[model samples]
Target: MASWDVIVIGSGAGGAPVAERLAAAGMNVLVLERGKRFTKAQFEDRDEIEWCRRDRFVPSILTDPHTRRADEAAKAMPTTDGWISSILGGGTIHMSGFFLRARPEDTKLGSRLKEQGTTGHSAVDWAVPFDDIARYYPTVEDEMGVSGIAGGKLAPLAEHPMANRAEATAKKLGLPIERTPRAILTAARPDDDRAACAYRLVCASYGCPNDARGSMLVTYLRRGEKSGKVTVWTEALVTKLEKAGPDRVSGVRVKRLDNGGVEETVTAGVVVLACGAIESARLLLLSGEGFNPGGNVGKNLWFSLYVDVNAWFPKATMPEVMTGSPFIHRSLMVGGALKADEQKTLGLDRAGMLDLLWQHDNPIHRAERLAIEGGGTLWGRALKERIKQHFTEGRSMLCEGFGESIPHAGAYVDLDPATKDQHGLPVARLTYAHHPRDRKVAEHLAKTGLAILKDMGGQNAFVRVGIGETLILQGGTTRFGDEAKDSVTSPAGLVHGLKNLYVTDGGVLPSSMTAPGTLTIVANALRVAAGIVKQAGAARP
Candidate 1:
C-alpha cells in the first residue's frame, strides 16, 4: 500500500493542471490514469478513419456487457452516447482546438433562463464572475502555450490571442468576424523546452500531431514529471473511493483493466476526482455515505447541440483550406427562448444538409445570393457552369449554429447495478434532456445562421439539415456554488463536506457558458491550484 498527500484521478483538461501545481508546491502527488500514455509522434498524418473513426487521439467508453438505458421505454438497449476517452490524455487528445473564453453574460445562465419564461430547469448561475477567472485564463494559456492575436474585433471582450489567418480574413471582409483564440502553442517558452504549434488545420475533433495544440500530455503531465514530485500510475482503473472517517476520503481502490486480476489500494490524505462529468458523479454516488445529501451530485447535466454548414467552390480548394474556421459569429446566440411545442411545430428535430457553390473562401456571399434566387437544380455540365459563374461572382460561406443546453434536474448519472468494469465495480449511466429553453436557443441560433449567410450574399441560404442539436457537449454535473445547499462543489472546487477533496473539470461547470467548455475547465484548475499553493504556504508559516 502506497500513500501520498494527494491523489488526482484522470489526466485530461481538469486533473493535469491541479496535479502539476500541487507537485510543484512540494506535495507528493500521485496521478492515476486508466489508459496508456500517448506521445505527439503517434498522432501525425493519420486519416479520418484512424483518427475520427477509431478515436486514435480520443478516449473510448468501456463496452461492458451491461449498459444502462436512458429511459424505461428504451430499457433493453444500452447507451453509446456517454462517450469518453479511455486513453491516458482523456478528451483533450481529440478535442477540436477551437477555443474561446466565456462571455461575462454567461455567468448568469439561470437568470437568463427565468427571463426566457422557463420554470422547470434546475440550471444555476456561476458563483464567480468571468472577471475573477480572467487572470487565471492567461496563466493557463501561457502554460498551454496558446496562439492568437489579442483583443481582436470579433468579440470586444475576447481578450485572448487570435489566429493570424483568421484575423486577416476578418479584416479583409470588414465583417464582424475576427481571429479565434486557440489552445495550441505558437511560440517557445523561455522556461521550458517544448515545441510550438504548427497550425496543422486538422484540429477539427482530432489531436494535433505536434505538441503545439496544448494537449495535457505535453503541458501539465510533462511538467509534473520534470518536477519529480508526482508519480503516475497508468492502467489503474479506480473502482471505489474508501472513506477513513465520515468526512475524510482515505484512498482509492483500483484494478488493472488489462488482466482484471490485480487489485491494489493506494491511500492518500486527499482525493481529487476529475474523471469527467459522467464518471465523477457516478463515483460519488457509489461512494455511498452522504456524498450528496442534497441529491445534486449528478442532477444537472447539459450538452450543446451542433449544427454545421459546409460549402463548395469552383476555384482551387487551396484558399478555403488556408482560412480554416476563424470567425465565430456569436450575435445570434441570444434570443427569447422557444417552447418545446414550438420547436416540434417548426420541424426542428433532425439534421439537414445544404450545398452552396461559389468562390473558394467566399461562401458567405454565395449563401446570400442563393437566398435571393430562391433555389435552382443543376445537373452535370450545367452544375459545373453554375459553380464557375458563382465562383467568379465571389459568393459562398460556411455557417454553423452551436446551441446551449439548459441544465435539468431530470438529467443525471447513476451507477448501473448490473454492469461492472474490470474491477467489478458498477458502471456509470447517464441521462440527459434538452429542456424547453435549450431547444429555443438552438432555434434562435438557426435563424441567426441563415441571417448571417444571407447578409453575406447567399441567395438561397438556409439552416443546415437535421433537428439542429447534438448531445455531445456535456457539462454541469459537479456544479460550483456559494451555498452547499445548491451545489456539490465550493467555488474553489473543493467538495462541501470533505476538506482535502478537490475537483477541477467539466463536471464543475457552474453554468453553460457561451464558449467551448474546455478553456474554462483548464483555467479553473489553474485558479484552484493557486489557492492550494497559498493555503500550503500559510500552513508552513
Candidate 2:
C-alpha cells in the first residue's frame, strides 16, 4: 500500500482543478481515473462510428448497467438514459463548451421559491453564496483560455444565414441576445501550449484534435503532471472509501483494471470524491454503515430539463444558408427568469435559458433523422435525393432551452437490489419522473423558440420537449447546505459529519441552475481546494 498527502478520485472538470491546485501547494497528490487516457493522434480522426455509435467514451450497458424507473412503485429496467462519459476528462472532452455561469438569483433559489409560495418541490439556497464562487470564475476563465466578452458583446457573431436572421428577428421582437462564452480558445495564448479552435464543426460529441477545447486532460491534468508533486493512475477504479473511524475516511480501495484483478488500499491524509453526481453517490452508498448518517447521501438527484426547437429555411430565398458556418456563438436569456404572473399561469417557480445555433453537420445523424421522418422507407436514389435537397435546398437551425429541474423527494439514486457490475458490486439505480411544473416551463420556452424562428422566416418549425433526463448535466445527489439532517456536505464541500472526506463535484450542487453545470463545477472545485490547502497549513507542525 502507498500513501499520499491528498488523493483525488475521477479526473474530470471537478477533480482535475483540485489536483492541480493541491500539487501546486506542495502536497503529494494522487489522482485515480477509471478510464484509459487517449492520445491526440487517437482523437484526430473524426470517426462518427467510433465516437458516437460504438460508445467509445461511455461504458457498455451489458457489463455496467444502471436501472431506471418512473417511480418507486414501478419496476426498474436496465437503461443508458443517465450515463455520461467514462473517459479520462469525462464529459468536458466532448462537451459543446457553452461555459455560462449561474445568475446571482440561482444561488438563492430556495428563498425565492419560498417567497413565491411554490410547493411540492425541494429547492434550497446554496450554503456558499454566489459571490463566494464568483471571485474564482476569473481564475478558471484565464487558465482555461475562455473566448467571449465578459459583459456581453456582439463582435464575434456566427456567419450563418439563420443565425444572422435570428439576431435581427430577436431585436425586432425586443428580446435580448448575447454572445455565449466558450472554453475554447479563439487564439493561441502566450502562456498556454494548446492551439486555437479549428472550427471543424465536430465538437459536441468528439474530442478536439488540436487541444483547443479546454478539457481537464489538456489543461489542469497537464499542469499537475508538470508540477512533479502529482501522480495519476489511469484504469484505476476506486471501489470503496476506507474508514478510519465513524466520522473520517482514511483512504480508498482501488482495483486495477489493466492488471489481473489486483486490489489495493492506499492511504491519504484527505480524500476528495469528484467522480460525478451519480457515481459519487453510488460510492458513498457502497461504503456503508458509518456513512449516510443523515439519510440524504443519495437523495435529491436532478437533471437539467431541456426542450429542442428546430427550423428549416430554403436556400433560394436565403442563399447564405448553403455556406459553411462556424460555431454559432449566440444565446438568449430574455425570458429565463419568469415574472410572477407568468409563473402563476405556467404553474412553475423557475424558467430557463435558450441557446441559438446552427444544426449539427454530421451526415450520418442527418441521414438517420431524415430516414426516421420518412418512415424509414427512403433508400438509394430517394435517399440521395433527400440528402441533396437537405444540403442544397435549405439549412436548419436549433434553439435549445436548458431549464432547471426542481428537486423533489421522488427523484433519487439508490443501490440496485439485484443488478451487479462485473466487479460483483451493486450498481446504482435511478428513480425519477419530471414534475408537472417542468413540463409547463419547457412548453413555455418552446413556444418562445417557435416564435423566434417563425419571425425569422423559417419553414417547418417544430419543438420537442424532452421528457427524459439530460444525463450529461446531472447533480444534487450529495447536496451541500447548512444542515446535516438535510444535506450530505457542508458549504466548504466537506461531508457533514466527516473530518477528512470531501466532495467537490456536481454532487455538492444544491440546485441545478438554468445553464450547463461545467463552469460552476470547476469554480467550486477551486474554492474547495483553497480551503483544503488552508486547513493543511494550519495543522502543520
Candidate 3:
C-alpha cells in the first residue's frame, strides 16, 4: 500500500480546503469521498419531482439509519429529517450559498451563557478569537470566487435585481436591509470555472446548472486536482479509522460502493476527518471505545433553531411577479447577549438571525405549501386553486429566522446497536432535546417573522416554528476548547492527545453562531490547513 502524507475524508466544504492547501504545499494527499463525482454535465438534471420528493439527493434512512429521540428514555425512531447529501461535494453541492460572517459577541458565547446563568455544553466559547478565525475569510472568498462589494474580508456584495421586492419592502418599512454576501458569482472571473448565475429558479436543494454557485467541487477541490499532488477516490466509504499506536491514526478502512463491496485499507501519516458534524462523530465513535475517552467525540450536537414566515401579496402589490429567488436580501440579527437597550423587548438573551427570501424555489415545495394551507389531500380542485392564487394574484414572500441551539450535554450522537447500514456498521443515533431558551427564542422569532411579513403588506400570513424545522442546520459535535478533558479537538482543530489526527469541519465550532454556517466552516478549514502546513514545517528534519 502506498502511504500518503495526508488523508482527508469527505471532499465537501470542510475537507476540500484542507486537502487543496496541503496538496498545493506539495504534500502527497488522498481524499476519500463516499458519493460519486459529478461534473457540470450531471448538474443539468433539475428534476424537482424525483430529486425533491424521492430520496435521490439524500440517502435512504433504511440503509444509513439515523434514529432520533427527545431524550434517553424515549425509543428512537428512524428519521428522514437528518437529511444531508452523501455526494462528492457533500451539502455544498446543493447549498443556497449564503455567506454570513459571525460577530465578536458570537466568539465569546460561553461567557454570555454563563453571564445569563444558563448551562451550555463544555466548549461554548471558541479556543481562538474572532480575529484569528476572521483572518482567513478573505482567502476563502477569493479562492472560492465569492462575489460581493470590495470582495475582501467583511465586505458587502453588489446588489442583485432579484433583491427588488425585498429592497422595496425594506425601504417602505424604513428597515436597514443590505445586500447579502453570496458565494455565487454575479460577474465572470478569470480564476473561476463557473459562469455567473443563470437565474435558474431551481437553486435550493438542487445543483447549479450554471456552476455559478461556488461549491467546493468547482472551487477548492478543482484547485486541488490541478495541483497534481491531490488524488480523489469517489464512492469510497470510510468505515473506521485505524489507530497505529498510542495517540496516532495509522490509516483508514474503506468500502467501495460500485466495485461489489470490495474493501481496502489505505495508509497515511496524518488523517483529517471532515465527514460533517454527525457522520464524522459517528465514524470516530466507530473507531473504537478507546478512541474517545472523555466521550466528547459525539457530544454537544446542535442545530440552528429555525422558523419560516411566508405570506402572500396581490400581483399589483409589486411591479412584477418574482420567479423564485432564494437570496435573503434582508436580515435582522438577534445577538447572543442582548444589548441593554433591547433587553426590555426581546425578553431572553440569545443569538438569532432572520432572512427574507422571495418565494419557494421548487414547485413540489409549493405543493407542500398547498397541503399546509389547503389541508391534507394532494389531489383536489381546492389545491389547484390555492396553487394558482400563490402564483398569480397572491405571490408569496418568506422571512426565515434562525436562533442558536444552546449546546448542552443532553443533546448528542451515539451509535445505534439495533440499526445497521448496508456495510453492517452501527448507524448514528441522535438524542436531541431543545434547550428551553432555544424554544423560547424560536417562539419569539416566529412572532417577529410574522411582523416582517406584515410590514411588507402580506395578507393571510403563515408562520411555522417549534420541532422538525431546524434539524437541517447541525453543528458542534467535535468541538474545540482549551481544556483537553472537555473538548475533542484543539483550537487548531487537531484532536486532543492525538498528534497526527485532526478535524477540519463545522464539528469543531465551539458554539452555534446564528447565521448561515458555511462561511465560518470554510474560513476555519483554511485556518486548520495553515496549522497543518506549520506542523509539517516544524517536523521537517
Candidate 4:
C-alpha cells in the first residue's frame, strides 16, 4: 500500500494536464491507468487488425461489455463498437488531433436553446463561459505543439491560417472555411527528441511514427515524469474508491493486470476521476454510498453528431492522381445552422463542420469501406480489378462532418443489472439515442456535404449517418451546474458533496460542442488542476 497527496484515475487528454500540474507543484501525485502502454518502437505503420479492429486502444467486448439500447423500454444488447480508448495515453494517442474550441454561443447554448423553446433534455449554459476557458487555450496549444495556419480571425478565434485545399475549395463553392488547429507538430523538436511529421498521410486510428501527433504520452506526461514527483501505475484497474471513517475518501482499491491477480490499495488525500465520460460515470455509480447518495452519478450520457461522405473523381478529368490532404485539412460551419427561424424548420440548434481530405491509401481500410458501399462481399477478380483501376487511375476524396448531440432524457449510462467484467465489477450500460433535432442536423450536414462533393465534379457519391460514426466524441454524463441538487459537480469541478473528489474529464463538460471535446477537456483540466493547487495550499498547516 502507498499514499499520496493526489490520485488521478486516467492518463488521457483530461487527466495528463492535471497530473503534470500537481506534480510540478511538488505534490506526490499517483496516476492509475487501466490499459497497456505501447512503446515508440511498437507503433509501426499499418497494423489495422491489431490496432484498429482488435482490443489495442479499446477493450474487447467479451471481457468488458456495454449494453446499448434506444431507451429504457427497449431491450439492451451488447455493443463494443463505441470509441473508448484504454491504452496508456488513452484517446489522445489515436486522435486525428483536431484541436477546435467551442464558441461563446456554444457555452450559452442551453439558455439560448431554452429561449428557442427546444427542450428535449437538460440543455443549459455552461457554468463557465468561453472567455473564462479561453485563458488556457494558447497554453495548451503551445505545450501540445498545435500547428495551425496564419491570419483568419473569426469571433473567439486567434489569427489562424486556413489550409490551402479547404480554403481553395470553399472559395470555389462559396462556402466559409476555417483552418484546422491540429495537435500535430509542424517541425522537429529538440527538447523531446521527437521528429516532425513524415506526412505518411494517415491519421484516423493509427499511431504516429514520428511523434508529430501531440499525444499526452509525448507532451504533458513526459514533462510530469521529469518533475520526479509523479508516478503512474499502468494496467492497474481501479475497482472501488474507499471511504475511511466519516464521509471522506480514504484510498482506492486496484487490481494489477500485469501480475497474477494482485490486488492493492493506495491511500490519497484527494482523488481526481478523469477516466473519460463513460467509465468515469460507471466508476462513480459503482462506488459505495456516501460518495454517491444523490443517484445523479450517471445521468445525461450523450455522443457527438457525425456524418461521412465519399466521392471518386475520374482520373481522366483530374489528370494527375491526388495523394492525400496532409498539412492543410480544411473545415467549415454551415452559417445559418442554428438561427431560431432556420432551426425551427431544420430542427437543429448548432452549426456543423465538414472536413475535406484526400482518400486514404490503407488496403484493409479500403476493403472495409468497399464492403459497406457494395452492401455485400466483393472478393477475387471484381475486388482486384477495382483496386487496380482506383489505385493507378482514379482519384478519391472524403468529406466528413460532425454536429453536437442534443442531450435528452432517455440517453444515459448506468451499471448493468447482471453483466460484470473479469474483475467482478459491473459493466457500463449505455442508453443512448439522438434527439429529433440532432437527427435533422446530421441529415443536413450529410446532404450539404454530398452537394459539395457533387459540385466538385465527383462520381459515385455516397453518404453515411449516425452509424456509430461519432461515438468516440462522447460526454455529458457527469455535468456540473449552478446548484448541487441538479448537478454532479460545481463549476470549479469538485463533486457536489465530496469536496476532495474532482472529475476533470469530458464527463464534467456540461454541454456538447460542434467539434471533438478533447481540446476543451484538456483546457478545463488545467483549470481544475489550478483550483486543486489553491485548495491544497489553504489546507496546509
Q: How many clashes (backbone N, Cα, C below 3 Å) per candidate?
A: 45, 0, 2, 2
Per-residue lDDT tens digits for candidate 2, residues 27-67, read: 99999988889878887978888888886887778988789
lDDT of 3 by residue, 1-541 (tens): 6699999998888899999999988899999988888878878888787767777667787677688888999998997656577788888898877777777777777887687676555437778888888988777777776665343543343333436656676667444555566787776655656677776656768788777888888888888898898899988999999988888889999888878878889999989999888889999999984567477888888787778887776767654445344354556653434445455565566547777777765776876877676345655887788777666665677778777777887788989878887788988899888776777777766776787788767778877544333565677888888766778888888888888888888888877787767888889998999989998999999
Candidate 4: where is the Cα deviation over 4 Å? 149-165, 324-328, 334-349, 466-469
Q: Show where candidate 3 strays beyond 4 Å.
A: 120-123, 149-175, 323-328, 334-341, 374-379, 466-469
Candidate 2: list runs displaced more than 4 Å: 151-161, 339-344, 347-349, 374-384, 466-468
Overall local distance difference test of candidate 3 = 0.77
Q: Which candidate model has the greater lDDT, 2 or 3?
A: 2
Candidate ranking (TM-score, best to worst): 2, 3, 4, 1
lDDT of 4: 0.77
Model 1: residue 218 alpha-carbon error in angstroms: 1.3
TM-scores of all models?
0.78, 0.95, 0.94, 0.93
As a whole number from 0 to 100, the lDDT of residue 146 in candidate 4 is 80
TM-score of candidate 2 against the unseen true structure: 0.95
Considering summed lDDT, which 10 consecutive residues are worst modelled in model 3? 153-162
lDDT of 1 at 134: 66
Error of 4 at 232 (Å): 1.1
